[model samples]
Every structure is written in C-alpha cells, then in structure tokens.
Target: MRRYTARLLGFLAVSAIAAFIGAGAYVYYGGYDTSALQQHSEPVYRVLQYVRERSILARSDFDTPDLTSLDWQHAGLMNYETYCRQCHGAPGRAPDSFSLGMKPAPTAIAELARKRSPQELYEVIEQGIKMTGMPAWAYRLNQAEMWQLVALVKQIANMTHADYDNYLVQAQEESPQQTETRPRRSEEIASATELPTMEGLSRIDAGRVAMQQYNCTSCHMIPGVTAARNQVGPPLGGITQRSYIAGLLEYSDNNLIKWIRFPTTVDKDTLMPDLGVSQVHAEAMLAYLKSVE
Candidate 1:
C-alpha cells in the first residue's frame, strides 16, 4: 500500500513540472499578442479592468473639498475646453476622430465623472492611467485647481442637456468685465488698441491683455482689473510689491514668464495650469504685471 501511494505522488509531481515547463516554453516562443490597437480578449480585459479599478480604490487618498467655494466650474471649464475636451469631450460634444483609433477608446469623462469617486478622479487626473492617451496634470496644475477640476466634472455629471449648454456658454463667458465695479471713463477703459498702433505690444499692455484674455481674475482680485472676486488664488494687484511668485518663485521677469508658461515646472501643486501660453504672450503678460506694480 505504501509503495503504491509513493508511485502515485511521483506521477503527480512529474505531471506538474511538465505542465510548468510547457507553459514557459509557450510564453518564450511569443504566444501572447502585444499590440496597442488590439482589444484585449475577455480574460485579459477582465483582469486588467479589475486591477485598475482595485488599484484606484486602494491608492486614492485625496480629500474632496467644498466645490461651492471655488465656484470653480468656470475656472475648470477653461482648461477643460483647452485641454481635456478634445479627448474626454463635453456633455453634448463628441470626441475627435483620432480618439476612436485607440484600442480602448476614451469615454466622455464628464459623464463618467458621475460614476467615480472624487479621489479616484483626482488620481486619474493627477497621475494619468498607463497605456492610454490621458496625460497627467500633476506638473501642470496645483492641488486646489485639480480639486476644482474634479468639482466641475461632478457638476457636469448631473447636468441636463440645456443646463450643460447654458453652463458651458456662461463658463466660457466668465470674463473679467463681469466683475466691473466703478464706472470707467472713456480714456480709463483699456481698449484693444489703447496702448499703441505698433506691431508689437509693450510689456505692460501685453501682460494686461493676456491676463484679461485668460481671465486671471477668475481666481484672484487684481486691484485695477475687473475680475470675479475669489479667495482661491491671491491677487496680483501689486505683484512687483511682493518678492516672489505664488509665494515660492523669485519675483523676476524671466521667472514670471516661466511661471506663466510652465507653472508646473515651478510648483507641482500650483493652482495654475499651462494654458500653452506662447513666449510672446508670456512676455506681454509679464510686462503688464510689472508696469501695474
């Protein structure tokens, strides 16, 4: 009886080893497909999806702030329009043609935001998912801005079609002029051509134009500018009066341009996003800021 049991154990161990070797050999010969365009088979998809979902659930630790305080819907909408809308799409808009070519196509994330937790949303935004075109903004946007983006996405999730359309229009129209307080005299009001009829704008005029165009006052309160008042970001009313930019960067012309164009490089958690400001725009904005101070 003992001899029979030993023989049976030996047969099982040999079979297991043979199975392991066969599987290794199959893998070594390139039996698996590795194409970005190919949709993962059911088994692969299920496993990957499970891992992604679980990892986000387990790793996400960001706190969801009071979205109302930021009134951040407009602040977020600008960047979303400039950056995310092309890939994730708006509530009523369709994604671009190239987004479809991806193996697992990007969804209209404004709708997807409804199904996700804020922490998970932040994780995805701050650190983009691998094997997809969704770029991370950890370097481009600060923590507060990231949360604001999340907040706007949450609103987008629950909006009706008309509400979305109106909201989008309103958000896009959130210009500095809306916050105008005292009446402006004809000469006091800055016009598109008030500075000079020259080819290039002076530094101060350039800065003023860029700030107004980008709606810098949406998050801050510049002394002379008409802008929505919010405590989310500080006022640059007398930026030159201060010694630093965003309380960290040195107060210099070169530094100001660098911050304007690539703030993420300056402060990883800055509320500012790289709106892809050109060298000319950055210089103009800097000139305006310096002149005002």
Candidate 2:
C-alpha cells in the first residue's frame, strides 16, 4: 500500500510539471495573441470582469461617508471631467475614439455610479483594476477630495444632459489654469492650514500637516493623527529606521525624494500616485520622518 501511494504521488507531480512546461512553451512560442484589437471572447471577458469586481469588493471595507448631502458634486464633476471624461463619456459627451477601440471599453460611469454604492465605486478609484488602463489616484488625492469626486459622480448620474453641460461651464469658470481647482469651499480645498514656515515648525509638525492634507493618514498610521489607524500601507512610526523604501531602493534623501515626488516611477505597479510634490516639501517631510525614530 505504501509503495502504491508513493507511485501515485510521483505520477501527479510529473503531470503537474508537464502541464507547467506545456503552458510556458505555448506562451513563449506566441501561441497566445497579444493584439489590442483582438477582443477577448465573451466568456473570457466575463471571467476577467468577475475577478476584477470581486477583487474590488473584497478590499473595499471603508465606511461610505456622508457624501450625498455634501456640496461635493461640483468638485466630483471637475474630477470626472479631468480624469474620466476622455475614456468614459459624460452625460452629454461621447468617449474619445481611441478609448472606444480598446478591448473591454471603459464603462459609462454615470450608469456605474448609479449601479454601485459609493464605497464600492471608491474602491475602484482608490485601487484601480489591474491590467486595465484605470490607474489608482490614492497617492495623488486626499480622502476628502476623493469623497467629493464620488459625490459629483452620483449627482451627474441623476442630472439631465442640459444640467451636466451647465455644470461643465461652471467648473471651467472656477478652474484657474495655474492654481488648484476644487469644489465650492469644501474643507478639501480650504487654504492649507495657516501654519508657520517649514523651518519655523518642527519637521514632525510640518510633515504631519502635509500628511493630513495629502490623506496619507488614510493608508498609513501617521504618528499624531486621530484618524490614522490605517492598514493598507505600512505604519510609518519607524519609517526612517528601515534600511529600504518599498524594499527595493536604498534608503537616502534622493531615493526618498523620488519615492515621494513620483512613487509610480519608482515602482510601476505601486498603488501610490504622483502628487506632484515639490522638492522642498519632500525634503522637509523626509526630515520629519527621519526624526520620528
């Protein structure tokens, strides 16, 4: 009986190896088509979509905030226009020609906004689907701003075509070419806390303010913020003590600066988005982070 069991196990192991080798050969030899225009068959597309949706649902544990009543629709509208309108048509617009050619074309987001809850939709925004053109903006935006974007989506989903067009005009008027564009007087765009200069304040104090504004606390356990019990990112209590950043780069000012200013450049698949942080801001934040040790 023991000898029979060993023979069966060896047979299964060999079969597994053979299957792996066959798959590798097929891929390496171009048995799979890699054309963008070659759309996946219905079954393949459905399966991929199911996996993406489930993955988003599994990770979206955040409580949906009070977004319905908030005057965030305007900010959300701008965000939609800037980040999404090109790929997913707005209420009165059509998606661009290039976006329509892609396989599994971007969904009409107004319909999507109506179908999914705010939390579910935010999951898609915060952690973009893999292998899809959709990229995560968590690194670029704060939690408050994200909520406003969501609010705008919900509002647009219910708006008449004329209302949406009117909205675009309004948003355009408010958007100064050089300065930041945000929703009407929401906390997200309220002038940065009237804090002292980075040099006048302790680095920790300055870093804390930057972190708060950037919504770092949403993903990381910042030392002093009350709402920083985050689990998505590594806690930053001993960030400076570590010898590496993201376990890939050597720990140094230049590396840290790059990581902060352009996290996606450091790692292509990183969830961190570019915030367009200035060199001076990153340097100051690094000083505070290093001091936290």
Candidate 3:
C-alpha cells in the first residue's frame, strides 16, 4: 500500500512537469501568432477580458476624493488633444494607423469609460500594465492630475464632437498672449533680477497654481503641476530640460515660443492651439517650467 502511494505521488509530479514543458514549448516555439492584425485566441482574449473587468472592479472600491472646484473637463480636453487623440481618438474621429498596430490596440476610452469607476481609471493611469503600450505615469505626474483624468474619463462618455471642439477653443482662449507690452515696475524687475530664492513651494507648485488658474492642467498632463496620471499628451515633466522643442525643432527660447504661438505652422497635424499667450507671461511660465529638474 505504501509503494502504491509513493508511485501515485511520483506520477502527479511527472504530470505537472510535462504540462509545464508543453506550455513552455508552445510559447517558445512560436506556436501562437502575435500580430495585432490577427484576432487573439479564445484563451488569450478571455484572459485579457477578465483582467480588464477584475482590475476595474477591485480598484473601484476606494473612495473618490473631493475635487469640487476643479474644472477637469477643460483640462481633459486639452490633454486629449495633446496626448490621447492620436491613439484613442475623439468622437467622429478614428485613431491613427500606427495605433491600430498596437497588439491590444488603444480603445476609444470615451465609449468604454462608462463601465469604469473613477478609482479604477486612476489606477490604470498611474500604475500602467506590463507588456502593454501604456506607460506608468506616477513618475511623471502628480496626484491631482491623475484625479483630473479620472474625472475627464467619466465625463467623456457622453460628450459630442462639438462639445470637444468647444472645450478645445476654451483651452486655446486661456493660453496667455505673446505680444502685450506691459512695463515692468522697477521693484518687480529688481526682484526678478535678484531671482527671489524659492523655498518650501517648488516651481512645480507655482506652475500648478498657474496651471489651475489658466486651466492648463484641465487639459494636458503637466508633470509636477497637476495630480492627474493621464497620458492625454506627452508628459511635461522635463520640457525645459529637453534639447529639442518638438522632435524636429532645436530647443531654444525663441523656438519654444514660436512653437507655442504657431504649432500648426510648425507641424500641420500638430494639435497644440494658438493660446494667445502674451510674451511676458509666456516667458515667466517658461522660466518656471525650465527651472524644474
């Protein structure tokens, strides 16, 4: 009887090893096609579907924090245009061709958003999943911006194309102008020259306040400025440190200003708007942004 029991245990162990070997072989031998153009197999598709549902359900249990006065819709619109629209697309628009090639292709969040709670959305934005094109945003954005994105995702489900365009217009209108010639008071210029020592509050903090006041954080993911973990536009964490403005333009104050003022001319497909930023305010904001390490 003891011999029979030992043999049974050995059989079980051998069976487990065989199963592991077979699964590994199938994966390593390229038995499955991984092209995005091809539909996922039943098992793979079911796993992804389960992950999507379960992750949302598990993360949704947390209490959503208060953001009573924040106008996230405006912030989201700008973010969407700057970062998300190319991949996720807006109402009546389709995602770009390259986005379609992504293995799990970026979904139009506007349609899928109704099913997720705010916290779930936030988790996805902040943590990001492995082996997916999605990037983890915790390192690049602050908590407030992440929450703003959650709010925007929730609101996007019912928005129309016109509504999105109108919000974009509002964001553009809020951008500071570049041509105003206000005389700097002597004291202000002297203080500026002295480079008032910054403490406790970082440039990021000041930028955050400026973002909120100007509604810049309402749209794009301004790293260190807002708390949203959105990928709506390229992260703005090290904009000042970049050696180039866009991928093509050489980085310079003039180039940055020109890009900000005339994004369309720089790149016809560029989504950035002429925000009408005045020269002085733009310079101040740029200085603050560049100061960020």
Candidate 4:
C-alpha cells in the first residue's frame, strides 16, 4: 500500500509539472488571445473573480470612519463626477462610449456598491485591482478624499436616477468652478497637509511634483511616488544606469533630457507622447530620475 501511494504521488507531481509547462508554452506561442476586445473565458474569469474577491476581503479589515455628513457626501459626489462617472456610470447615466469596449466592462457603481461594503470600496479605490482597467487614486487623492468616495458609493446604492441628477446639480451649485481638469497641477486637488506649491521645493522635489502634474504615474512606475506602480511603460527607476534611452540614444543627461522633452522626435514609433516638457522642468525631472537609484 505504501509503495502504491508513493507511485501515485509521483505521477501526480509529474502531471502537474507537465500541465504548468504546457500552459506556459501555450502562452509563449501566442495561443492565447491577449486582446482587450476579447473577454476572459468562463473558467479564467471565475478564477480571477475568486482571487479578486479573496484579496479584497483579506485586506479590507480596517474600520470605516463616520461617513454621515452631507458635506462629505458632496465632496464624494465631486470626486465621483470627476474620476469615476465616465467608467462606472451612475443610476441615470451610461458610461462613456470608450468604456463599453473594455473587456469585463466597467460595472454599474450603484450595483457594485450594493454588493460591497464601504471598507471594500475604500480598499478597491486606494489599491486598484490588477488586470482591471481601474487605476489607483492614492497618489491623486488623500485618505479623506478616498473615504469621501466610499461615502458617495454608499449613497449611490440608495439614490434614484432623479436623486443622483439633483445631487449633481446641487454639488455643481455649491462649488461652481471647482471641478478638477486633467492638465491642472495635482496640488490644486491635494489636501491641506500637502505642499500647496512646488515653488520652495528643491529641483528634485519639484520634478517629482511635475511628474504627478503631468500624470506620468498613469503609465510608468516612478520611484518616490505612491500609486505610481502601473506597468504600462518601463519603470523610471535606475534609468540613469541604463546604457541607452529607448535603445536608440546612448545614455547621457542631454540624451535623456531630449528624450523626455521630445520623445516623438527621437523615435516616432515610441508609445511615449510629447508631453511638452519645458527645459527647466526637464532638467528638474532628470535630477529626480538620477536620484532614483
């Protein structure tokens, strides 16, 4: 019986190793459709769903603060309108046209809120789910602002279409010109505890601010910046140590500066866009990137 059991275990281990190697080879050979246009197969979706739920549930053990204030809800409304409404539509609204094309399309905020606790909502907001289009807002929003979003999500669960529309109108009236725009500096929306301006900061510090201002965190995993861990582009860490910039220009401060300021000029096919970095800002950013080692 002992020898029979040992043989069975050996067979099982070999089978598992073969399965893993086969899966890897399948992926390596491009047998899997990696397009965002294709939704996950049911088995894959179920596994991902299980992982997502378990991960959120395990990490979302913190206590949610008092979210009962009208002021807080209004703040939440503003944040929702600015950041979330386009993807996760409200009761009376449909998500923007582009969002519909996303595989595992953005879920209804109202329905999601009903299914999830405030703690879970806060966790998901602060730490975005992987393999999902959701981006972490921790770099852009303070703890209070994130909580405000949780409050808004909770309220969204209970609101009617007319109620949400009225809330938007009231929120707009309350803060007539306070909506945040993409091109605006991040400090404008930052909490009072944060530096109001980059004026007095060192060049390196200011460069870090400039990175956030230009929304570089949306793509690259930048050092010295929270929630800047997106893998859409190569990480900026140890960039100074690299032998080349974009594998075209030899590594040098001037070359890097040129790359930052006018990426398209150097390599037109690069996914990097010309963000129109000024000379001073480019130098400052180079200083910060140099310090990342």
Candidate 5:
C-alpha cells in the first residue's frame, strides 16, 4: 500500500510539473494570436463570458432609481447618443466601423438590456468591464447621468429604428446644446484640475482612478493597474525610490505635481504631454506611486 501511494504521489508531481512547463512554453512561444482582428476561440470566449456574467452578478447590488419617468428616459436618450451610440449602436443602426473591429466586439446593447436587470445595467455602465474596451464612466458621468443612461438602455429593446429616431429628434429639440457637441480633451483635462474633492475613496484609490481617466497606462506601466505594460515611458513600479522625475526634476511632492501638470515646462524635449492634472489629483497620484514600492 505504501509503495502504491508513493508511486501515485510521484506521478501526480510529475504531471503537475509537465503541465506547468507546457503552459510556460506555450506562452513563451506566442502560441495564441493576440491581434484585435483575431477573435477569441469558442472555449475561451465562453469562459470569459461566464466570468464576466458572474462578476457582474456578484457586484450588481445597486438600488435602481425610478426609471419610468419620461424626463428620465429623455435624459437617458441624450446621454446615450453622446456616449454610447458610437460603440454599441442603436436600433436599426450598426456600431462604428472601428468598434466593429474590436475583438470580442462590443455586445449588442439592446440585447444586454433585454436580458439584464436595471441594476446589472447600471453597474456595467458605472464600473465598466476591463480589457473589453469598456471604460468606467464613473469619473466622467455623475450618478444621475449614469442612472439616466440605464433608463435609456431599459427602453432601447422596444424601440424600432423609427422609434429611436423620433425619440432622438425629440431629445435633440429638448436639449440642443447637450447633444450637439462633445467636450474636447483639453477642456476635459482643465476641468479635472478644478474637480471637487472625490468622496468615499482614499487618496490612493482616487489617484488610481485618475490614472485610468488620464490614460496614463497607455504610456507607463503602473503597478496594480491592468493594460499598463506599454513601454513608451519608464515603468513606475519603483518611482518613489527613483532619484528624479522625467530624468530632470528632483523627486518631491511639489516637483512631481509641477511635472505632472506641466510636463512641457519641465522638459521641452520630452514626449510627455501636459495632462493638466489637478493639484489634488497630482498629490493623490504621488501617494499611489510612493505606496507602490
């Protein structure tokens, strides 16, 4: 019995090691295509869908607002036109050509609305799904605006293309300025500088959210953030221990804030753009950077 048990353990250990080595080789050899043009395999797609659904279900503990009012629905319609239509498409419309190219392409919003509860929709709109090109709108849209978006989504499934067009026309007439133009990036950055203090979140947490909002991960590899592996700039894992900011300014809270808000002023030759980070947000970002090590 002892001999048999010893043999069984040895086989299990060998199998585990072999599986690990195979996985490593597969990764190292680039066994899978990662281009957005390539779709996920059926098994991988199903697994990801399952995980996404479960994650949403687990976190969708929101209390739905009274979304039955026409006022709320109209507000939702306008917001949808501004923020959602480009990616998710509308009744009798297709998503933008660029969005159609996304791997695991943006899901049909009408279908999602038809199947999911209001709370589920709200959570998705507010928090966003990671790695799926969905952005968390919490930083951009206020609570009421997000809830209004949910209200619009709830009504989308029933609307035909004509119905949507009619509603959109009415919404446009009601709020001409709201849907007529989108805010520019410079305006957005300037507004961020003047943003009121964020409630509930710690400084570091707020900073992390600010990092995402500012698209910092597109250039710098920040610890504890996803899709932050771009090598355009230096990795920030040990930024706190580093002697300098942007290899010019000495590392300190004031210097870091100045660099973050006005990178061009600090280094005219550097590629880093001035993101107009707020003093509060800069401090928050600094706190997160210091804590990373």
Candidate 6:
C-alpha cells in the first residue's frame, strides 16, 4: 500500500510537469492562432459560449415586462438604426464587415432576444460587458433613454425588414446628420446643476431634467433628452422600452433601484458614478422611469 501511494504521487507530479511544459511551449512558440479573421477553435468557442451563457444566467434575474402597450416603438426603432444595426444587423441586413472579424462575434439580437428576459436585455445595453467590445453607456445615457432602448430590443425578434427600414427612415428624420451628431456637453453640465433643486417631478420629467442638468446628453445620444447634434453614447430614443438594462441586468424596479442608488455596488469596476442621488430622488426617478411604457 505504501509503495502504491508513492507511485501514484510520482505519476501525478510527472503529469503536472508535463502539462505545464506543453502549455509553456505552446505560448513561447506562438502555436495558438492570433489572427482575428480565423474562427475560434472548438475548445475556445465552447469556453466563450459557456461564459456568455453563464453570464446571462447569473446576472439576469428580473421578471420579463409586457411590451405590448409600450409607446416608444418609434424611438426604439430609431435608436436601433443609429447604434445597434451595424453590429447586430436588421431583418434583411448583414452586420458590417468589421463586426464579422470580432471574436465571439456579436450575435443577432433578433435571435438572441428570443432566449432572454427584458431585464437581462436592459442590463446589457446599460452596463455592457467587460473584456468584450461592448461599452458601458451609464455615463452617457440617463435612465429614461436606457429604458427606451430596452423597449426596442424586446420587439426585434418579430421585426420585419420593411418595419426596420421604416424605423431607419424615422431615425434619420429624428436626426438628419450623422457625423456631427452627439449629445451636447453643456446640456449635461446644466442638468447636473439643477438636479439638487428639483422637487416632486415625475420620473420622466426628472430624468429629462437630470439628463440636462448633468450634461448627460453631451456624452450620450438620447432623442428627447438632448439635441440631435451630440451622440457620444449610442442613440437612446426608446430605452425605456428595452427589456435589459446593461445587456446583463434584467430591467426590474428593484434592479433599477440598485443601479441608480449604487451602480458600482453591483459591478465594482463600472465607469458610472453614484451621482450622489438621494433615496427619495432615486425612488422618484424609478417611478418616472417605470412610467416610460
């Protein structure tokens, strides 16, 4: 028995050494493909797939909201055309050529939405994901605009090509020029200035005021929140209509509460600030936001 134990230990040690040496060789000799154009190996693909699935499962917890009566359909459509269509594609459109080269390429939201809850969808749009190409829009967008985008994503699964095109036209009409567009910095700064003084305002009005007070429009593209000239963040015409918040967090009242009161508490490294919002203000903000649809 003693001899057998010794032999087993020796074998384990040898295996460990051999595995490390092989991995070291692979790294040093550049054995793994580095080209972005190349498709991922089966193992790599499986790992990434698992990561995405697990991420969604763990982060998305809110109940799905009813999108039938949500009135931001046009806003959602416009935002999608300006911000999302290039990577996710529309009913008859293909993703841009550059998007194809991305590892774990951006999935068609139209297809992915079928498997997700609205809250989860909202999280992805608002917070985005780390180590992926997705960027956080919390600093850029206010709560209302975020929700509008959420509403639009909910309808992507059933959108027809003609419907998408019409939306594109509407978005163009909402904001005619592309290159010079972005939210204005001055508006955001002004919004922040008056945020402390506003009282008893509805969430929508509060959000609009907050956005303008903080100059949120300067960095983000919210249709009614700011002018058509500024679009640092993706367009947010119909965010309230979206199902997800940050492409991860489900759009729930509680989650939105947490997000507004303590953004970094949920994700420590998030770029969004706490913004010094009081609980009263947070509650009012959420109440106004929930009224979007």
TM-scores vs. true structure, each candidate: 0.53, 0.62, 0.55, 0.67, 0.81, 0.58
Model 4 per-residue lDDT tens digits across residues 204-265? 99788768656789989998887747988899999999999889999999999899878999
Q: For model 2, how does the per-residue alpha-carbon lDDT over 1-293 read when each residue is reduced to its tens digit? A: 99999999999999999999999999999988979879888899999989988887887776788887665646666777667778888887998888988766888877887887788878777656766878665535556667787787777778888988887777767765513443231223323432223435676676665666566777888676668388788988777778999888988878987898789988999987776565555666787777776
Residue-level lDDT of model 1, residues 156-220, one tens digit each, is 87776687677667876774443322322222222233222113555666566557655577787
Q: In model 6, which regions exceed 4 Å deviation?
A: 63-71, 174-293
The list of candidate 4 runs beyond 4 A from truth reads 1-6, 70-73, 179-184, 189-292
* Candidate 3 error regions (>4 Å): 1-4, 176-293
Estimate the lDDT of model 1.
Answer: 0.69
Clashes counted in candidate 5 amount to 0
Compared with the true structure, all predictions reach lDDT values of 0.69, 0.72, 0.64, 0.80, 0.80, 0.65
Candidate 5: lDDT over CA atoms?
A: 0.80
lDDT of 2 at 157: 71
Q: Rank the candidates by TM-score, best first.
A: 5, 4, 2, 6, 3, 1
Q: What TM-score number comes out for model 4?
A: 0.67
Supply candidate 4's per-residue lDDT for 48.
Answer: 85
Candidate 5, which ten residues in sequence have the lowest lDDT sum? 188-197
What TM-score does candidate 2 get on C-alpha atoms? 0.62
**lDDT of candidate 5 at residue 127, scale 0 to 100:** 82
Q: Give the alpha carbon lDDT tens digit for every residue of 45-164 in model 5.
A: 999999999999998885766888535557778778778888999999888788988877898988987998988988888788988998877666667777888888878878899999
Model 1 misplaced stretches (Cα beyond 4 Å): 1-30, 175-293
